[model samples]
Target: MAQVLFLGGLGRSGTTLVERLLGELPGICALGEVVHLWQRDLRDDERCGCGSRFSGCTFWQRVGERAFGGWANVDVDRVHTLRDGVERTRHIPRLASAAQPAAQVREYASYYSRVYAAAAEVSGAKLVVDSSKHSALAHVLRAAGDIDLRVVHVVRDARGVAYSWTKRVARPETDGADEMTRYSPGRSALLWNAHNAAFGLLARRGVPVRRIRYEEFLADPRAAIIRLADFAGLAPRPEDLEFLRPGYADLRVGHSAAGNPMRFTVGRLPLRHDDAWMRALPPAQRRLVGAMCGPMLRAYGYPLNPQEAR
Candidate 1:
């Protein structure tokens, strides 16, 4: 069985950075957004974090060989079908319960178990980090019965999330030719609510979940990361975290599966809490996001009013 530190949250909520930070730890291998692995890497042949095409990346090629004797042995379409049938947002309820779906769901979960275990085996890391950011996928993976899955639920203020969605950020993994997807303020808020709510239900189901607000994590990166490392079952010495020096972190290029373009960044990167949304987001739109997020905004420790948040 593989122990996976699963980062579950909505996009742009800072899971990618956390994944990167965890990857730098001595015995952890970060595999970004494994939820998108089938389509993004195997089907599309996108670039891996190592800056090589998926087919050309030696790391994933070995992972494929180790996991299923080879990627060729797996039925991509059947795996997709099984995943689609049992990993939808609607299936979270049943997937998290004792009466979790059998049959295809179990079969689907077996694939993830193999994938994670192979990642650990190939990298020779004590644990693997996956920033999949989907609660439904977390539930599906938990059904495997052979994985030690730990969840880190990242939350950001909905207003910031709405502002981020409105931005036209480029998708560098797609050769900077395509931009990332965008969503309306209402839709972003609703997703923020729905995603965070699922994690709440996930925690009650006895999963080892550590909820970290994006704002708080940035405010104290050093302490925050150490706490997160501990929760994920790693006991790091002070020297193990020398990557965090003052306000910047020393990063390295990784062979991630799929994620934000930031995953490719290396060397030193500045860290800060992105509060631009407070001023840049239109007042009306900010209020709309707040209203849409409703109680979840407060439930996650976000102040309802814009002023109080600051």
Candidate 2:
């Protein structure tokens, strides 16, 4: 069975960077946010992690040929419709059943199984990393039983995530303002609690999960990656730890569908901690996120200071 290490968490929580670092390991091939492949990349023709457009990427071209006898044969709209309906918060729990396969789930899993298996074949890596950060998608993969799945739930401070969503970070591939995402503090915090809570439910339902806080990761990425490697059942080598250094990484293109513009990042990848929100974010907004997050922030070890909440 192909080994799939799925990253489940809220967006802008360092999931992309973690995937990039882990992708650099010897036995791991990181495929950025394949959950968005059909809708974003295939339909919209977004830029790939490498500098090429998704459809133009030669690596993904081969993958399409391998997985679905070329992308032309696949129905993108149907895939998305099924995804929105079945692979969602309300529909995922039903996937726990082994006897009766939900037709949509079965079909979706079949599509992804081919993708993951082909990634393994093409990349020659034993582990395929999918940093989709979608709990429902992760649950579908787990319940499908076609592959061996493990989860890494990446989290960051809700305040930081809120601040991040507020910024208009551009996609290097696009000169226009179409692809950017923005979220208010209240929405960011509420989703953060919901996503984490969903992953918690998944864990309780017997999915193997490993939680990693982004702050702790930045403090010592080497240790963090090693812990992750161990959880994925990979033997960590000394060189596998080298990519965590505070410098550029020799990144290559993968058949990733969508994610941060960091996919376009090559060469030096600065592994510094980002705490700009602590200073730049308005105090009121910080407090807003803190209040919306409520006990969840404390549960994640982020104490809501009265001063910050003010």
Candidate maximizing lDDT = 1
| C-alpha TM-score for every candidate | 0.98, 0.92
Off by over 4 Å in 2: 92-101, 246-255, 306-310
Residue 207 in model 2: shift from native, Å?
1.0
Q: Rate the local accuracy (lDDT) of all candidates.
A: 0.89, 0.82
Give the range of the ten consecutive residues with the poorest summed lDDT in model 1. 93-102
Error (Å) of candidate 1 at residue 20 is 0.4
Tell how far residue 272 is off in model 2, in angstroms: 1.4
User: Once all C-alphas are superposed, what RMSD does model 1 give against the true structure?
Assistant: 1.1
Best by TM-score: 1
Alpha-carbon deviation at 295 in model 1, angstroms? 0.8
State residue 307's C-alpha deviation in candidate 1, in Å. 1.9
Total backbone clashes of candidate 2, pairs 3 or more residues apart or in separate chains? 2
* Candidate 1 accuracy as lDDT: 0.89
Candidate 1 clashes between residue pairs 3 or more apart in a chain or in different chains: none
